[model samples]
Target: MTEATATRTDAQATAPAKQTKKVHLIIERQDNPNSQPYTEEFLVDYVPGMNVIACLMAIQRNPVNKDGKPVAPVAWEMNCLEEVCGACMMVINGKPRQACSAIVDKLQQPIRLKPARTFPVVRDLVVDRSRMFEALKKIKAWIPIDGTYDLGPGPRMPERDRQWAYELSRCFTCGACVEACPNVNERSSYIGPFAISQARLFNAHPTGAMHREERLEALMGEGGIHECGNSQNCVQVCPKGIPLTTSIAAMNRQVTYYALGSWLKK
Candidate 1:
């Protein structure tokens, strides 16, 4: 082949691979807590192994819409991008989950992002998760300690029970279970699955058991375990794979016995 033709052929053979199409996202946005929500489209250069948070960062960096117009940067919460802090929780493509773990490659094209409506929308992809915290407070999901001095080593637990308790302790309070739960909507005061699971976790603790009856009583009150419709949605959407429904059932049995005991005394 001629020198010029040979060089051209080699160049053609060595041509770079076609660029990948950009990732498309339809994000539901709200200007403020009381403002109406609207959908906005964004396109970001596709990157290998990128997660939803990466896509959001791209949009944040550019703050441009699909139509090439500049806009306000989207607002969302995230911490410990490793998914431990549970601050990155949001509804991705209609499922409540952690955005940090939702890999872009696995997500469908034109992925939809929205705040979990189970909580009040703060803005854009941010939601007010205070209610879940309030529920936790209501149930007193904690071990009481005077903290005046070192209490020394606490009581021990059986190996099997400790292992199971460890699993329950994985809860990061992401509120994914609450968002998935139908019983936890605005019309109801349901304390939610994570709270129930947390109550169970603490109640099983050697030191925390001191307030077991109090937690059980909270679970038995209005907007308590009885409010659960048993739709089983909480367990399905939990990012930590916490056995929320199982906790609910166990707490239910405990509440039942507590009620019977209280009635007998009366």
Candidate 2:
């Protein structure tokens, strides 16, 4: 070969091999409730239809970093990979969502994962969702039954109301709505949107209507319905697409009527 051609061939051979595209994952992790949080980077093999949970599992199997150093396996919560169970909710790429449904293909490069900061981080991507359930208790988000005995075919619901009620019933207490809500932070006891929607759900039930006044009254109190700032972030993030803001507005109207009714009674 000519000297010039040989030089060009050698230069081409010496060129660095193009690094294969790897799935870069940066996870925010904490060892315990009181420990300082840290970030860990992991490069996992990319796979089609892979979700956050799958990536987490890959890390768990190898527990290695991008530098190929051995590390601790990632910890997270998951159930019903279909997103029906909200146990897998975490902040993925700056948005709170179900890890099982957060497909890697749809996420940005260097997928960032973090525990939902709106709640106490238990460890890694797992968070204590007890506050959400506690809010449910605060709102008494259920229909009270007189007894466990057979109450044959309880009061019927109108077809139209049932249609809307079905939408509210889809909430799995996933905590995504609460995580997405700015008003539900440490500074506020707003009880978040899910509880309010639950209250609306139960309140619409014919039998549940008996406690409608009580639910409304609870919502009227401190950390009640009025705390909602109407950011409307909850609706956008809810996997089930539960109409949260609509429930807030509907409950607001109901509470207003209940307040006026109580005044008339007085």
Candidate 3:
């Protein structure tokens, strides 16, 4: 072979190979509410832009562990893969975040997935968020528009206030704030930060402010704003960056005013 031809052939033969990799995942699993918890390891071929949810789906396709033993496919809740639904919240490497947004490339090797411990673990990486929902119910976190009729723009808010209110409206109830909060646990009745921010959202609205007294009263009750430890963990972990601490502080002032007013009324 000619020297130039041989050089070209060698280059073709020894071209750099694509670096394909398989991500390893260690999932904490529980078959049922009453079943004992266990760890299951899985290996999935890497694909560009793959998230943790995609890895779980890969394992679901073939229910086998790292040891190659057949096992039940892991169960999880996911909706709106864009992280808007907050249904796929889980503890990824000890940080609470939505699995849909947890890209494999950004994650550390041997990614660890677990259920958020702030709520009851129903199954693998799926916890019952009913407690937080119940807290919302307890506070009646909605504007009451009585009688089904077109009120036709009942009220309007100032542009500046509306801008701040819009920030509070971004909460998806993903539970990352709750999971990061130390006050939310089995023993404490703290309602968590999301609800407090929500209270602020509605209260800032001109029409919603009619029931501000009721909302403030609810915050004064058990599992209310007083339960907040002010550790500020909720703000740090909130994926939406909803300014939770500000809401908490605002509600704190409201609750204090309510208490003083009630005392003076007596």
Root-mean-square deviation (CA) per prediction: 4.0, 3.6, 3.9
All candidates: TM-score: 0.92, 0.91, 0.91
**Candidate 3 has which clashing residue pairs, if any?**
none
Displacement of residue 165 (Cα, Å) in model 1 is 0.6
Instruction: Give the local distance difference test score of model 3.
Output: 0.90
Candidate 3: worst-modelled 10 consecutive residues by lDDT: 12-21
Cα lDDT of model 3 by residue, 1-266, tens digit: 69999999887778657345788999999988888989999988799999999999998998888898999898999999998899999999999999999999999989999999788889888899998788788777888888688777678789999999988888988899999998887888899999999998888888889999889988988999989999999999999889999999999988888899989999
Q: What is the lDDT of residue 202 in candidate 2?
A: 93
Q: Which stretches in model 1 have alpha-carbon errors above 4 Å? A: 1-20, 147-151
**Candidate 2 per-residue C-alpha lDDT over 1-266 given as tens digits, one digit per residue, 9 for 90 to 100:** 69999999887787657334468999999999889999999999887889989999999999999888998899999989998989999999999999999999999979999999888989998899998888888888888876768777788899999999999999998888888888887788888999899999999999999888888888988799989999999999999999999999999999889899899999
Query: Lowest lDDT 10-mer window, candidate 2?
Result: 13-22
Tens-digit per-residue lDDT, 1-266, candidate 1: 69999999887787666445699999999999999899999999898999999999999999999999999999999999998999989999999999999999999988999999988889898888898889999899899977889999889887988998998999998999989898887788998899999999999999999899899889988788899999999999988888888999998888899999999999
